[model samples]
Target: MAAQYDAVIVGAGFGGMGAAIQLHRLGHRRLLILEREDDLGGTWHVNRYPGLAVDIPSATYSYSFEPNPHWSRLFAPGAELKQYAEHVAEKYGLRPHMRFGTVVTGAHWVEEESHWRVAIAGGDSVTATYLCTATGFLSQPKVPDIEGIEDFGGKVIHTTAWDDDYDLTGKRAAIIGTGATAVQLIPEVAKVAADLTVYQRTPIWVSPKPDYRIPPRLRRLFARIPLAQKVVRAVGSGLLELLMISGVVHYRRLRIANRIAERYCRAHLFRQVRDPELRRKLTPDYSFGCKRPTFSNTYFRAFTKPHVHLETSRIERVEEQAIVTADGRRTEIDVLLLATGFNLWDVNFPAIEIIGRDGKNLGKWWRENRFQAYEGVTVPGFPNLVSLNSPYSYSGLSYFTTIECQMQHIDRLFRAMRARNAKVFEVSQQANDRFLELMRDKVGDSVFALGQCATANSYYFNQHGEATLLRPTSTRNAQREAVRFPLSDYTYA
Candidate 1:
């Protein structure tokens, strides 16, 4: 079967869904979504790991336009979130526009016509004038490099891509890596697993989630008086802004936040782990903000369980029935779990080479000269291509805020092109270069570059060793910067 559309969106996450809903509302009727999973929720659909839930308040995490004041709790569980995404799709009647269980492996731009020839398996193709890569940052799972991984006889699970049939009850489990996923899983798994050994490469600073069930009456009140919830969100967002403000100015507030986090961690450490030697070993050496700060309601208490063991030694390798640490200690377990997080800065679309004007391959161009996008959506050589959660656009606030801004900018970009009967709309090389110059010079000095962070493997930094991806900034500030590169900044041929 052959199909055509004005735009092709990849991945069905918050970014892709936001694009679809907004574009459909804006009168782009012929749009198609390619999703690898059978379900509508991208990350939420896949990660069925135990005790998975959002850290942010449920009221603020949703779409601002389609507010769901019916959240059951302050932070929603994964199942609730999955159902929420499905509900949004149903409400917007977006199912017919989606193609589920289809994996898009590659895409290329046909230079003359300026259309994207997206290639998928089974010798299928769909050509569209505009391509939107909404494959969000967390879609790809990153398993760490471990020796003798194949030798583990018991079932192995990755938190990002989980197996629902994995039964942890009465099982001795050796969990590797203590990132966000591990923090959530530890408490749940400790309840059932006979013995739980959590391998921590470095300790992470965590705060009480302050989460609770939102009663129906309160939810109804939120729906009616959304301003109250909005104010709460604003206040929380403002608190986060201090980190960016201080980091941007190289002020002492950065140190203040760091000291506060350190003190909190110490309090928790002494409160939970009574052994001074273990507490010292578990303490982190780097600053708190350098890593993605983890929030948990019961993560610290989970460590206090008698059945739970905290292993600090780096894993040497896996044997048939045990995990061998560097100290030659063997931790025998019935299952091994990987809580290693996602590949943050990895480009989602890399299989197909895109050739633009001057016949430059996209990958080669990006490698030779770093990815240059005006507002991190439109590229200099590529015409009519818009990406979501794209490079350099990862804000500290909600993704909905950023995507809506990008979509609005894209709409303006295309409107400008249509008004002028432009054959191609590509950012001028000067505009692209200037954007990168601002990114590295003006923006990279923020708290996102916490060189003193404990979790040193964060994907926020790019190849140039600069933190250009995730940062703390207000929606107004981000949109202002994004909308600054007016459609006129791009050469419309």
Candidate 2:
């Protein structure tokens, strides 16, 4: 017989940990968390590249239920974030339920048994009445398929898998892709590298980050009066909510925000880059918020450095010791970096073969159906299975908001199941269809759909070019929907 548990969570990240804590508090003690890596913290555990920090304010990045008063800066570094994750886990006593170095290969719903049989990578199996996965939105790295990349003689590093032991002092480095990851690391790399070449496919609109160190006095005050930190979090969340409303939810009604963001971006660019040619090259052609907005203070300044060269030519191929452009320009470098981002908004990383009722593979079903989920958690055919960070479920502002909303949603479902003595529960196809229809109706007016995002090469859309990734609702609205939504939308057995 396989090991049994009341619930099996396929991650140890924020969402998974939050779910575990909520379930534990709800008297569901038979819980297990499986983490693929040798430790917790998910992305923070794996992404240890230089200058890695939270783009959002530290006050808002954390869980509202468990506020941290000891953040060192407005934007906490990756190390601090990892420690915070550990702190939360230890505080909730989640370590006892977590199995490190365990990778889930697949799961199948056993209708006759009314349970889920989860298969581990090493042939071990586990049985759970409920299965939840929180592998995260950008857990999978998107490596570019450039020609001759494998034949390169020098070192190649992806931001997701940074080898800290590899030294970069005085070495010629070439960085590819200018997304969020590149903006963060390029400045730090430019300082030490003898010469750096940044290959840019498309310029990103970057806003000035108001990052600063949190004073020890403020930390002490927060510790003394927890309400202080709560107030700060509320304020931060309010600001981001307004941003979301302008940029995502009510973009049509309030498009002045685009002008404001663009104005700031252009001013910042002009202030940093003295050369008109460089400034023009760095400006984005599309409307603001068409792509994900980035915040950086040092990325622009890095271009002004004598040792740093920005290459706008399209990459043709990679030579043994050089990167060749389409214009036949070859840049020599000792180190090559890929900042191509993750396979977010397209597919879940470390995808499991989820065999639902009637032998329907979840991956295949999504491919056929164009990736629709009932509130990004429950599916029609997959009974007793809940997936986190699913399509049309993601809120743009903060992951904490999403996690809290999802945890509350899951908690409500479990409570409903317990009240009715239900052994199995699944979303009705009607409910899934209704929710998807509502999302499609609402998304037509949102910025992602109307804001020229189709031309921006963004990850917000699926293969069909529909903006199905973001939830067209505010965080507060989502939270309320999670709690107040009727349980009759699902069928229980």
Candidate 3:
């Protein structure tokens, strides 16, 4: 006999926790949260590399329902965020409902039983009436396919899987991939390593981060009046919405901002790096916001250091000792750091074989249909299943914005189900197609579609070269649409 649950949520991270909290509040009983890891705080717990911090402002990154007045810095560190996750779990009594160290390997819809039978690792199974996968977009870490990568005798570490025991001090370190993680880790690695070489595949647009600690006076005021924190978050969100509109959505409208951003980058590069040649090498040729934009005040400054060297060449292969370049230059490295990002659009889903209607694999369906979801929540064939952080479902600069919107959407669907006395809520294929059509129309005008995103080699695009990852709308529009959209779009049975 399988343990039964009203709802079974996957991945106890921000998305999972948020879903659990919302479901519980909405009167869901016998809900279970299955976390693969022994603990919660999914991404925050895993990526513990040096100098790791949230790029977004701390004020906006948090949930609107629960605002913490005691964030130590404007850009909170990984540990603090992890503590915050634990705090949320403890605060809401979510720990009791969570089954840590439990991995859900597969899920099959029991059409006759009108429930989902989930197969777990270690020979266990569970049944749930409602299934919500909050597995997250960036959950799976992507390692580059390079020859002799496994043959490396030295310590080769990915930023996602940081070995706390491994020391980088006085060792010749080489960091591959100059994306967000590299931008943060390089400066910290340069501080300790004897010599550091940053191998850049593509130059990314990095803006200055205005990060500082919140004054105790302000914290006290936020604690005294929570509205104060809400106001701050609202203002920041508004500003970010404008950025998203002009820079991301309107596409061509970002010319002015692009000029300003490039100027700022050039000025910052000039101020930080002494060598003109190095500065030029660091400068990006692509337009701003082509790929995911980054922020770091110290990354460029790290290059000014004598021990740091920037190598922008095709990596020939990964030898036991050195990373050889196309031009036949080999740099000896004691520690190899891979800042290579996640498997975003490449079958990035819950680590479970989900068999929907008629034994249709959700993974195969997604790949076949180009990853379409009805409002990024429900698939046509997957009855009573909701996916948080799904493709084209994700919007807003802050993930909290996306989570909140998703929660609202889920709440609406739940309310609809109750009102109609529906046992199943599956979106119609027509509805899903219409939603994708709208997204396609909106994305056509966005920088991701019209801009240099294709050449930028961004994860925003799938293997099919379609920009279906991000919701092509402003945060406010996305939120409003998710909440107020027509429920008739889905079929209630």
Candidate 4:
């Protein structure tokens, strides 16, 4: 007989941990968290490249229930995030339930048993009453399809799998992609590399990062008075909502807000880069918030350095020790760094093969029809399953907000299930369709629908040219709906 668990959660990241913690609180103790990585922290553990830190303010980045008042900076470094994850796991007793280096191949619903049979990589399987996939939005790394990249003789490294031991000091380095990750990394690499070339396919909108070290006195006050920290978190969240959430997600209603944000970013760029041509090259052709914007003080300044070269030409191919461009320009480098982002719609949509009722494949169904989930948690065909990183799931600027909102949804859902003595539950097709329509209508008013996003090449927009990732609503509204959503939406057994 396979090992049995009340709930089996794939991916032992913060999302899995949060799910486990919520389940434990609901009196469902038989849990197992499967992680492909050797340890926890998910992306925090996977990404260890220099200049890695949370783009959002640290105050708002963490779980609202458990806030860390000891962050060294307003925007804590990646190491601090790892430590925070460890602290959460230890405090919540999640370690024993987690199995590290465990690969989950797929899962299928067993109708007769009314349970999920989760398959492991080595032909072994586990039975769970409920299955939750929290594999994260950016779990799978995307390798660029540039010709002759495989034949490159020099050291090639992807940001996801950074080799910290291998020093880049005195070495010529070329970084491809200028997304949020590249924005943070380029400045650091420019400081050390003998010659640094930044390959830009699309210019990123970058604002001045108001990063500062938290004074010891302030930290002490926060540790002593938790409410003080809560106030700070509120302020931080409000700013993020006004700038990112409203300016971008609510672009139709808040066009002026978006323009103000765009002007601010442009002004920041102008202030940093003296050369008009360089500033123009750095400016994005697409509307602001078409792609995700990032905060970086040093990113613009890095290009002004003598050894740092910004290459705007399209990449033709990679030679043994040189990168050739479409403009017949060739640049030789000792190390090639791929800051290319993740494969979202293709590989990471479901993150794993999930077979639902009547031989319905979840991935296939979504691709064939549309990517959606009722309330961004439960689907119509899949019973007793919650996809944490589903379409229209991400509510606010902070991921913690999304997690907490989903937790609320799960808590309310499970409470209803327990009250009715139900063993199985699935979202109704009517509910799913209604929710999908609501999201479509809401997103129709956003920047993705109204603005110039053709040049953005953003992951937010899927293969269908629909921005299905973020929930086009405020954090408070998401939380309210999670708790107050009608129970009749789901059919319980």
Candidate 5:
């Protein structure tokens, strides 16, 4: 018999697991999860760099329903996070429904039957009524297009797809791009490598993590008083929210705070660096909040090490044994690490080949696109398909809140599927267009639009210089939508 499911979830990350768990609790079966990797934990499984850690505090970073009490660190490491995803899968008995190592390369909408025909890389196709794409932003590595890269006689690795075989124990290392990955990785690389060099194009604002471990005594107390831990989590989440609210509402205040942070960083961080010009080279020219702010206690101080060298020259090309800069300089390395982030926007729409009404390819249709969703999950025309962290739905806020928010809207679409007994559901195109305009207009008023930050070329911006990648909706507003998905704005097909 053909495997027909109510929904087919792609990727076994927290988003997919959460969707499956919610459906199971709602008593909906006929669900299958397809994961490309041999394991779960989408980003967590892939990113195994030395200094990888969660940007958000782990207290509120987890699912609200199944909070882990035994989190060893405040900002959990990659391994711990991967374990968290697996634990959730096991705890909810979600493992049975998944087919690991199966990649759903393409999903075609069968308009005649109103079902999605999903194609696995090395297996038979499956038909699903609904398709959920959770292939996260960080899944694909953004290796820069530099000439002579293939000729380099060094072990090259992207932070997204780490090559664990290469031993960096005593080798000279070079890390390209000083973004989020570099912020965490530099300190760790400094510890192991005989000598390390960080090649830079830009600098990111570094802030203190305030990260600490969960003491066993505190864990015991929390175990005894569950509500107390919940209270603590709530308080921690509230503090994070307060920070977000202040940053969003008052752009200037956020800018000033970033400047203060930069000053603090220079005084406490860069002051110890003996070379004044080198210290200046390390400072960022863009507004701190323009690009994503990174947190690390030792990222700046890593430069103070005698073994670590910070290079500011533009990488002209890669040679067999060395990197050639624009000024005819060569920096040799035994291993090279690309801290560059994944490709955004281009990954969505046409890349997935989502052909909607009348053979319309989604990517081509929106040449002047603005990321808009009626509820941050559903698009006007693309019905029965929900994005995990779709546009205007993502924020620098906790992924926990954003994922939960998206899931709520998705639940509404699910309910509508049941309530009307409808074969397919889609957002009205007119509604999406208007919402898209509103999203662009709203974001145009923000600091990111002013180009005061380093995000000018970062994935943070869409072609129109708007940040449609992340959901900027406040948590308070999103929770209301999640509690009950609003169906009024969307038209059922």
Candidate 6:
């Protein structure tokens, strides 16, 4: 017999935790949170590499309702984020509902019972009236498909599963991929490795990171007066929103702002690297905001070090202990580190198999038709299911903004369901289509549509060459619509 739950939230990260908290507030106490990993914190727990830190300011990276006043730095380290996740879980009593080390293979909607049948890795299963998949966008690790990689007789590690026991001191290391993860890691690897080689396929735009340790006095003040912390949070959120709005979302209208941002990034790189050739190799050819940009003060400087070398040639193959370039240059290394990003369009779009009404596969439907969700939460056929990491779901620069906005949407939705005394609620196809059309119109003027992004090789562009990952609106607008969306958009029974 399968255990029954009022709601089953997948992935015990902040998204899932937020969903659980909101559901509890809606009087859905019979809940379960299933996590594949051994613990919570999601990326923060999985990624423990050196120089791991949040790219956004700490003030805006947390939940708006529960702010942490004791962040050690402006951009807090990954460990502090994990600690904060633990703190939130404990404070909200979410730990009791979490089941770690539980892998969810798939889920299917049981129309007769008006519930979801969630299949676990083993033979066990659970039934829930409502299903919410909060599995993050970057949960799946992408192993590179390099030829002869298995023949390499050296230590290999991916950024997602970093081995802390192995020492990098004096080791010759070669890293593949120069994405945002590599931006944070390359500097730390250069400091210890006797020889470090960074292979770049696409150069990422990196602005100057204004990172600094917060003083104890400021921490005390925040703890004593919550309003002071709220003021700082508002300032941080405002700056990030301004960047997103002027530089990316409104690129067609604010081309000058985008160009200015690109020039600022170039200046940051020029200040660190004196060599013109190196500067050229580091600079991105595409327009700024085509892909997600990161903040780092030391990434460009790391290449200027004597021990670090940047390789621009494409990798031809991997030998036993050396990497062969397209130009026939072979570089020997003692360790291979892969900073390759996730497979978002392929395996990560749904994260797990989801079957809605009439045997409609969510992943297949998105790939066959289009990737979209109503207000980035519910699908027309998927009743009582909320996908936190759906298409056009990510709002603003900070992920917490998206999470909170979705939380508000869920709260409003459940309240309406309760008022109607409905056991089943699903988004109408008309509403989903209307929202999709609105998003398409909104993104039509953005950088991905108007600017040159063909050379970016960004994850933002999915398989269909559509940038459907981010919501093409301001965070305030997203939040406003989350609360003010027409209740008639959904069919309640």
The lDDT for every candidate, in the order shown, is 0.74, 0.86, 0.85, 0.93, 0.74, 0.94
Off by over 4 Å in 5: 1-3, 249-275, 348-351, 454-456
Q: How close is candidate 3 to the true structure, as a TM-score?
A: 0.97
Positional deviation of 225 in candidate 1, in angstroms?
3.5
For model 4, the local distance difference test gives 0.93
lDDT of 6 at 58: 98
Per-candidate TM-score against the hidden true structure:
0.92, 0.97, 0.97, 0.99, 0.93, 0.99
Stronger candidate by TM-score (3 vs 5): 3
How well does candidate 6 match the true structure in TM-score terms? 0.99
Tell me which residue pairs clash in candidate 6: none
lDDT of 3 at 290: 70
RMSD of each: 2.7, 1.4, 1.5, 0.9, 2.4, 1.0
State the local distance difference test value for candidate 2: 0.86
Query: Per-residue lDDT for 1-493 in model 2, tens only?
Result: 3338989999998989988998897888999999998999998888999999998899999898888899999999999999999999999999999999998999998877878899998889999988888888888888888999999999999999998899999999999999888999999999999999999988888988989999999999999999999998888888877764566666777777667777988999999999999998899887777677788999999999999999999899999999999999988999999989988644572266789898988888887887788887888899988888688777757888888888888888888988999868899999999999998888877787677665577777677788777788777788898898789998988
lDDT of 3 by residue, 1-493 (tens): 3338989998899999999988887898789999988899989988899999988888999999999898888888989999999999999989999898998888989888888988899999899988989888888889999888899889999998899999899999999998888899999999999999999988887877888888999999999999999998888777766654467777766666556666776777777778889988888877667778778999998988999999998899999999999999999999999999998766475456788888888888888877788788888888988888677987877888889888998889889988999868888989889998999988888877666665587888888888887888878788888789898898888
Better structure of 1 and 5 per lDDT: 5
Model 2: what TM-score? Answer: 0.97
- Backbone Cα, N, C clashes tallied per candidate: 1, 0, 0, 0, 6, 0
lDDT winner between 3 and 5, please give it: 3
Model 5's alpha-carbon lDDT is: 0.74
User: Weakest 10 consecutive residues, lDDT, candidate 6?
Assistant: 239-248
Which portions of model 3 show Cα errors greater than 4 Å? 1-3
1 against 2, candidate with superior TM-score: 2
What lDDT is reached at residue 381 by model 4? 90
Which residue segments of model 1 deviate by more than 4 Å? Answer: 1-3, 243-254, 345-355, 448-455, 471-474
